[model samples]
Target: MARTNDDVAAMLEEYADLLAITGGPDFKIRVYQKAARSIGAHVTDIAGYDTTELRQIPNVGESIARKVAGYLRSGTVPQLEELRGRIPAGVRALTRIPALGPKRAMALHQRLGVDSPESLEAAIHAGALHGLPGFGEKTEENLLHGIALLRDAGERVHLGVAMPLAEDIVTALRAVEGCHRCGYAGSLRRMKDTIGDIDIVATSNRPKVLMSAFVALSQVTEVILHGDTKTSVRTGQGLQVDLRVVPPDAWGAAMQYFTGAKAHNIRTREIAVHRKLKLSEYGLFDAVTDELIVSKTEEEVYQRLGLPWIPPTLREDIGEIEAALAGELPDLVTEEDVRGDLHTHTELTDGHASLEEMVAAAAERGYAYYGVTDHGPKLYMQQMTLDKALAQRERVRELDGTSGLRLLHGVELNIDPDGDVDWPPDVLAGFDVCVASVHSHFDLPQDRTTRRLVRAAEHPCVNIIGHPSARLIGRRPPIDADWDEVFQACARSGTALEINAFPDRLDLAAELIRRARRYGVKFAVDSDSHAVGHLANLRYGIGTAQRGWLTADDVINTWPLDRLTAFLRKKQAAGVSRP
Candidate 1:
């Protein structure tokens, strides 16, 4: 098999570490690290290249190329294996976990005999890890908490969570006089699901006035950190909100800098640096003239830097700049593109809106159709019964005749750990559509989690996979699984991925959306609304699609009623029988 980029990176990383462990010179160690980085950043398929081509690169030498060739041929780099034997794999895995550095890992291993994450967790639970030499109880507690937090979250939260909090803050801030154009910056602006901290940028002539207004907001119960230009507050929800005031002229530059993934901005700045121009919060400045070039808008700054306007979500330090230069920055999806919502709930289940009320709300939003997918038999918390669910579907059908909206009688079926949904074949076939979801067994191992999800996706009646990872914004991490494998199964099974638009459950983040898109897996941008007010969450779901570089064509719900029905029919025709 050909060597994957991850394979090459792992080998290079191991080699770099071996060089260091062997007391090699810092420059020598850096050479291997550089080679690894160059391999990762290379946009072209390095796996497609021969060993000779790999060696021709500036960083990769003959020895490294030989190792690459061996890895490609045998699926193992002997050098990496040797290094793994010399150093401990447990120590390396510990480094990958956030907050636990190499020194800390070493200390934990030596003092507490906690070499692996499992062992560390055991130590933590037993209260055996309170304080060690050179480490205090506070540090241990922080480490424990960090481990749990990291374990709880994937890389980012779904856009659904980030957008609402952002809007709420903006609304509160906009109430302040002189608070001109208060908007969210950072990943939240980019529509990232899991935001680190809410970055609110306000352009104001009277910034102090706005700042005073911000600190006095009802949502902000206590100010954690405050300053003249910036203020940090702990909200009612366990989230930190940061507000920054910038001059009107510098709004664009400041927004660009502040609403960044940092790495993305650094790459953008590199382009500026190469052009003998400086880009910063102040604005873009010409190096030779030492004069301000662009100051009013982010668009002007990008144009001045000889680049296309890049979206905040695509600002991963990846090859987006080159893509932008090549005019290939994806044409992202918009709110107008979303034709309808799929995985919504009604008062028949745990929802606060009645069937008529929900359909009327969807019609008011000009949707051609809406899927009233209330909770199914497994989620008894919603107090749903088979007879009541059937009655509810009949009621939806009843309203559809007069409502002019094509209503889909759908059920959000809970996929048990054994991969069985609560519905039999007769019941499953009764509904127009079914969304299979995992509501429990969150802490399953990687293989089991992957299997459980794949099994659910493969269900004959499962038209869509609802929140495949079962992540709850900041509170719960996604189930451990090979998402590529899971999405590939979804593609094979003709199951669509639902971007649940509930503020707390944007399960599939933008990156996953991008991956699923690549796998030819379709998406359903669902409101997953529990009440009338939650119908507005469609915007958050649409924002997520945009951030994922999704177009209208990429989403299943964007299709008209007939097209959607045809797609469902096709999926049913091709799918296998449920076990």
Candidate 2:
């Protein structure tokens, strides 16, 4: 079995958690956690290297390298297995609940024997939690709420969580001796906002070796099935991944069959039937003689059907087939089309990096411009006072010339309950760009929420509405709002809505973006990055935008620097003021 970088990382993370619960040395636990972070963030496969090479990776010391080597050589680490034996798996799962750290989880396990979510819920309802230290009525209530949220978020994982795991597994599969090609398919490949499970397809001569290696991955906590052609496993993160190996002759057909929404595949099969051909996971065959036709590439399959190859993102049976037949498929926005990131943060508020560092990171990515839109004074723990804002602006101005990147000094002003910004007009006018956002009152009535957004959009100083829907995937639903009304106001007022690139908040979802496009609403795909590493989230935003059928022209950040600057200036010049 070939281990991926994520496998090593997950093992280390689990080791750290179990060690912590078992009262292991704090320094040792920290070392494992740090090593896990380094491995998880490494661009390439750390598991492919020997112990000496592994030690060269940042935060991976001699001890961690030896453990990693041991895990790769054998299926399990002795220390991790020992710790797992001491702590029940259910207790470890408790730590994943909100507000339940390892220490608290241990307390629950030792004091009340509450190990799982169900047991914890039972304890809370039975009033068994009240007498425990640090567990009051309020704490119990919060725990119950968290449990409900967890239950509601069952089975599905966010794109951010699932994507890396899938990529790691795919990388591992590709490393096999006889593997020709391997890639993820299904919803993850489609770049859906949330994914249920991951599906991977590969072409390989040695199906038994490929399947065996896949099921033996370090991340595989449980193997559901193992066969010559197919293997399925559940990872440590509770994501089920299935890998299928096919002959080179059936590569395209296998990919098309597995990378499907059931409806889309049904439609395609229906088309095949109409053409007097048979399409299956094996290959396309002639109806009369059953002769195998082309099956090496997706384009070949589509060509055989007399249709242009549709992008995987648009294969949702959402009029994409008709559009392809008519030669009208949208030239969707790609990551390369983006010129800048309009919504970003800095140390002045909640961001991890300084303004100069953030700007340098953006410039490194070949961005023409980067906005410094740290939070304004309204957001708790992330408040930027007027003095701090002014000082930050001055700093930005000083670095603007020497930084070799165009820096737009800006602020992310909070939209209050009344749909009004916290800052006065003069304060708002001082910045080159202002992103208005709602950080509170997510439960407002739909009409009130719509009015609030409309009011924010109508403000002349506002250039973009940040994370307009404010949905945290798998955690919280989008705030109730009449999106059509809000879109109308934004289109009329020239305020671009943001496709927030944050993995957890791919706001202004694809479906909504598609509908808003009808009203001529412009969009900005922003990273809303708090740290330099988070800037990579821009790809997820671009994927979401593409899923919405957005074009380069539809996203303002894709415009040239001069054009974008001119648009912002025009919006500022409109002279509309807050009521």
Candidate 3:
């Protein structure tokens, strides 16, 4: 019974959240919350230590250490269990809404008997919140929007969270003696932004051994189903995973069937039917003879149906079947096509890593060039001033080409409500590149918001529009805009739209990217990285680009260094002298 830092942290946070809902003393509650954070963030395992040793962690006193020992011993203490008995779990779940706090969650429960997200939504729609203090008509609207956000995120985990776990499991299982092939499938294999569940497919004769190994995985919190062919388990993060063991001969067919977007699979089955054949998870077979045709590879199956093998990303049945029939499938972009990251940060702003460290890391990635686009002065709390910006520029000049990477000094200028940027022409012209983004004013009416974005894109000094939609996946809905005008402005002004790669804000979402492409607008698949490690998020961004049907030619970052810099020079080429 070993516990990772996240495991301990989650338990502590849950206890603190429940405590707040139960109206515990403020000081005591604060003490437990602080201790929980300390234990969760500690570099070493808290379980291996005695109570006295545990006290070495910040904020953990004798009492807190005893609680930690209790948690490690049986996963909970008697005190926490007693509190859990008094509070319904749904009440705790209510606090997950963005603006809803523990106090309000409790208020809803006691005042209106709303204890869950579903009940809370019902209350909002029924206008039950109107007369309550601090709850207005606007509040009601926002709550409804919040519920939709929750629903959009329903039952699915972020690909960032699920992919690593699946990769780990697949790697381990592939090493087992009986396994012939192993990999994750479903929407995860399709590279969807959010995944419903993880599916692992393994081809083996000894299904019993595979099931035993899967159930015995250390990350498993609960085992729901266990059998020879299929086994299901729940992880500590509440993600469900299923492992299916099939015969070695059925490996290719199982991979294709399970890796499916249902509509795409339906199209394949339809083709099979027309060809006087049968297609199933087990294999493909002849209709009349009932004989196996092709089940050894996806390519073989697709070839038998008169088409080339389609990339998993394009298997969403969105014009892909027709394109395959015409032999016009796009050669989608890949991580190797990207030359460098354009939107990154350093310690001068909100970034955790410094210029030198970030530079060395970029060099390690073998980037042809890299851009340091720290927050401009408008962000305020980052304390960026003209002096600081210039000093960093001097450093960039010093480090340029020192490590096989040509560095560019840049700024992520904030676009204000009126669509104005942080600096005047000369100041902006000082940087090698500029990326503008909307940081606030998310609730503007459609026409006004559209005008705001168009103005930003048409700025003479702005080289790129960063995270155009400003949506935080499941947390914030995309702002309403007449997007055709936005893309047209980008095309006219030579301002590339960003495919920001931060896990939470994979901005310029796939649907919009496709539309923008139709406008002949180019894109930069930037990591939008704040730390060196954040650069690896490029894979997710590439996934999004492929989903949008983007090719290497559609992305400006895939160009050679000279071509990319020429694209960045649109500011100077605009011939508009700023006042």
Candidate 4:
């Protein structure tokens, strides 16, 4: 409902893509992209800033800063609008398809008058593309496949984009006088990787008072529905938000009902039915007489139903009710359990923040230890070299224990197609941590993918597998691996898998984390952060880990520094080479 960094970055990035499609200069295109990244990663919101203040964001030069200021002040940039008017929207839409860059998009529009995916597909099928330069038969097939992938990705917004907006609304409404309670629910509360919409619940004697504030808020662009009980509104960005008000006594039941997967609510209602009780948003009541039994707290509702309160993340009807019945529900990991973050970046690589700024942020979060794992050489665009990495490590050492945050000088080593990492054994051994990850070769066959990841996990130099699936939510699908075998390899190798909390990439997804935990594979809940602002993404990682049923015991970053250091040295203890 509110403007986010994602919104700003997306607008600027679209301008860049459209410029490239129009034969804009390569260097200029790169400038827009870089400014998009810097502005998106800036710790503070740029919406309130003037041109001078906006220029503080890296890569936002005089001209770019002025454009950003224009956007913030007037909600549009003239240049971007002019470009949008010139290009057919579908031409820009073509770039969203995998393997279809701006060049291909432009070619499609120019050669075949295929301005959209539908037209492009028709052109391909009508054999209109047979003799085109890059649109061969194989390319057509791949294009069709890419279109299907894009379709399946759907239009869900990333959790990163939705959470802050919802949190802002909750905070604002909670301050209204006479408001009894306020919180957001639904899948956002469940901490899903993406969100379709947001649900907020509140209790107040004056329903009109809350509804007035809800629809009147600056975020609400259009009032879709208005009623005493519920109100729905659309944001300028088209995210729908529903606000519901109930009596104070119905607060708990209302929250539980709204914060639901259909399966979970059905199961809870069935439990109530079995006990000759009734469960509804109003309260748990006597099934026959409708006498309210419990309506005040979620714990009481679950207690009356002969179950323990399940965490919102586990309310997916995935054996959570059964586990609760058996008193075997997991002590799920919480944000507080995280004592440090093991995967983060700096200006040394792709991150917008410098080493000191990132470290200061970590210290502010009261982290006991933080690993600065910048990109290594294979991510060539970063131009990271041994000399650069060493220089950063030296700075990290200088900063360690300076502000009560122990710094682990680390590198995010790219796992090559052959399962080898970026650095040689001697070089890798020098770092306090080596987070090996798959940066490319995402389309390898399942067998090769499985073997590749397993080999990386078992590598003595590799400590954590960063974003193991290498997924980008709706953008890229996870690697198809025989994860059971890989998990077994990691367990035996004492290699920890990372639960990257970078919103779009909540990698080593919940299902994989659960499966890996069965083999006793430990995990690191890390904010694969690229900015100072990104450090807060760890909460999403914690949610992801909880959904996977991880306890603090299953996560290495939750351990005290001594134990974490010992665990990091496990590969060294194994007496191994890449030696």
Candidate of highest lDDT:
4
**Cα distance off (Å), candidate 1, residue 26:** 13
TM-score of each: 0.73, 0.73, 0.73, 0.73
lDDT of 1 by residue, 1-579 (tens): 222665687678877765565456888777787677657655344666777899876578887788777877787877678767765777666666656766677667667877677678788778787656666776666667666655654344445555677788899888888777788888777776666678898888888898888888888876855787788875665466889887888889888888767667867788899999998887999888979888788899888888888888777655577779898888877778777888888888888988888888888888888888999978978888889987887788788745578888999999888778988867888889898899998888877788888888888888999987788876877787878888898898888998877767776776678767888898898888888888988877777777677888889899988889887777667757664
What's the residue-level lDDT of 159 in candidate 2? 85
Clashes of 3: 0
* Deviation from native of the Cα of residue 336 in model 4, angstroms: 1.0
Candidate 2 lDDT (Cα, whole model)? Answer: 0.86
Error of 3 at 26 (Å): 57
Q: Give RMSD to native, each candidate.
A: 7.1, 19.7, 19.8, 19.3
Worst 10 residues of 4 by lDDT: 38-47
**Over the stretch 47-159, how does candidate 2's per-residue lDDT look in tens digits?**
45889998977678888898999998886999889888878899998987867788988999999998799999998888888779988887887788768757855468878
Q: For candidate 4, lDDT tens digit of each residue in 1-579? A: 223555788888998999999999998997888677666544345667888888777678899888888887788999999998888999998998868999989988988788888788788779998889977788898899778757765378989989999999999999998799999999999998889889999998999999999999899897867999899987877688999999999998998899977667878998999999999988999989989999988888989999888899988766687789999999998998889999999988899999999999999999999999999999899999999888888888888899889999999999888798887888988999999999999999988898898889888889999999999998998887877788898898889999999999999888678768888999999998899999999999999999899999999999999999999997788774431
Write model 3 residue lDDT over 58-92, tens digit each, in one string: 67888878877787778778887887887788999
Please list the C-alpha lDDT of all candidates, in the order they appear: 0.78, 0.86, 0.85, 0.88
Clashing pairs in 4: none
- Provide the clashing-pair count of each candidate structure: 6, 0, 0, 0
Q: Rank the candidates by lDDT, best first.
A: 4, 2, 3, 1
